[model samples]
Target: MVIFLAETAQVLAQTPQSLKPAPDAEAGAQAYADNCARCHGPTGAGDGRDSKRMHPRPRKLSEGVFKFRTTASGTPPTDEDLYETISNGLPGSRMPDFQRLPEDVRWQLVYHVKSLSAAFQDKPEPLAFGKDPGKGANLAKGKELYTQLGCNACHGPQGRGNGPSAATLVDQWGDHIDAANLTQGWSYRSGSSPRDVLVRLMTGLDGTPMPSYAEAVKPEEVWDLAYYVHSIQAEPRWSSKVAAVREELGWDKAPRTDLRLSSTFYRNGEIVPSSVRAVSVQAMYNEKEILFRLTWHDRSESRETPSDAAAVVLLEDPNSRWRSGSLRGWTGKTEPAELLSYEDGEWTALLKRPLPSGKRAGLGVMVWDGGNAEQGRHRSNSNWMELILK
Candidate 1:
């Protein structure tokens, strides 16, 4: 029989005093039975009746391995993290948002979820995520540590996930796991903020090949490496809001391309339409910033709700093999241009970023039309297009 005593205690211990009434395990069990058991199994083994049919499959709660967390990878997530996941659900997966549930009920579910794994019996204390090293965030030091720490063995020299050991990696369940392509922060399973990356480095993903660096490097050095990771991020083009500046830069007559886009492959090997078949791109740059005007046709405008959207991705390596293939896994590491869009049957967006000192930049584009229920991993994308800097 699974006991909730320890798990409940853990929750109470971690929760802030203001957010209390300490979660009731009995209540949590009922809530779990009513909602989660259908997909998570009665015992949380991930063998529920619906589990086998789902692509990527439901997570095995008993193993206590989580992909989205604010804590160190191997460490049990805080009660708050669990509450957030329960409330928001995992994007791109079958997990449904439970924001409609009462707050206490959600907290109850957090407790019950913890009870599923004995791994929670002796929870590790949270790590202190110190401040960034400021001026001490040295890229050179970080680059050196990246090599000395053997990160290149798996993450590759360019942080492209093409290292020699990358091909043979697998997770605890023996499912293949890719070495993180460090260039793309938007796709990070746990958020891509600087603090997020720092937590990952210190805690390491518990059940995967990624290990924690808590013992390997000093906290200050970790900050250095974190900043180093930040340094290689693809820079965006920033343009002045002045209309005359835009015209002087020839933004009015920028070259355009109507490129075809297709659905990214689903885990089950299904190919779906991006709802949008084509996209138009017009790009221009001023002395201080760069701008891209994108136009795509769609029947409905989905701005108010979590619906249709688009993105401009810039690659760190122009020669990457993923230049023309699917954008599924590539979005995580690439730098994304900030975008603002307007819609009236046809959607128009102005993507802008700061200009870097380089003569050329690798660029990619993607569109999401929510009318077809497209979001997350489901969308249309283009291969790399080299943007020559003037």
Candidate 2:
């Protein structure tokens, strides 16, 4: 059987130049004003009104220092690099993808972005990359290089970005920098293929402490290291979270389905980046009712009535729309179906409701960390997941 390379590599290698929309800086300026001004500012200064609330705050585009680039350090990224960033956005950061915009508009924004700083005046080209040689790279060799190259110093022994030196690193402008969490490849700003990782290894992130390994490592060996890093990457499995409620014996002992949760955000699209990142869910049902048990970690315990609370919402139900009032503040006739408990920086919430006539329904969750001032709209949430009833 023939196997293809990763799609990310195909995106990088197969994007034809003829298909790109023409570069128009003036049009790009307008697009930037409409889409990016809230965080990046009108002049690309990274001083928008919402910048203060943002962690790892928006990039100061006027400075012309980019973190993800195929070019050598200290040079402006090529136009394609800028286009790719605009299209893909930084996953872990507040910079969201603009792929929804038209191709021409996105191309225009790239030129306008480059025009913000004088560094692009040189119009330098990106460095060339050889084909990935070590396909199923030697994990053992990669582990050795990861140590010999001192990647563990800042990225930790497990690539969790928790090394002893992680807390002390900063960018060129003295802003604090968090080492990339290598295990979460989905959050990688650059594409997460072996080829993509190879690029990062060869061309270090500019303006940050991550240095290029181009001079120190052999080409083949670096490919092996990249493959190993790729192997550690993980992402959430939304499908596995499907709560299949069966009428089996010992309903109370049903296996819990786990799903990861992420921080809530502002109405204007700013993510709060909270500490609560995961939750375990168990669902059981009888002829009369359905019960859901959700457990999650919270460092602080807030007993504030209805404040440090958790709620399970039936998102598809018109009565329990996401924009509805708080758990206790339900303006509708339906009563809130929630029970919560907290102990030792952990939360266990039991939410029960009558079984619907339908065979399947959508369920969602919202968590409030009152100690962290998470109330009202400021809370963690999960996307509506399918609950199968048998």
Q: List the global CA lDDT of all models.
A: 0.64, 0.69
How well is each residue in 209-294 modelled by candidate 1, as lDDT tens digits? 98888888998889888878766643322221111123365755665665556566464444433445456777777777767777
Candidate 2 lDDT over 186-252, as tens digits, reads 5566678888888888889987899988879888888889988988775544343456466574546
- Candidate 2: residue 277 Cα off by (Å): 4.5
Error of 1 at 187 (Å): 0.4
Candidate 2 residue pairs in backbone clash: none
Residue ranges of candidate 2 with Cα displaced over 4 Å: 1-23, 123-125, 134-136, 240-260, 265-270, 275-325, 328-379, 384-390
Candidate 2 residue 329 C-alpha distance from true site, Å: 13
- Best-fitting candidate, scored by lDDT: 2
- lDDT at 370, model 1: 63
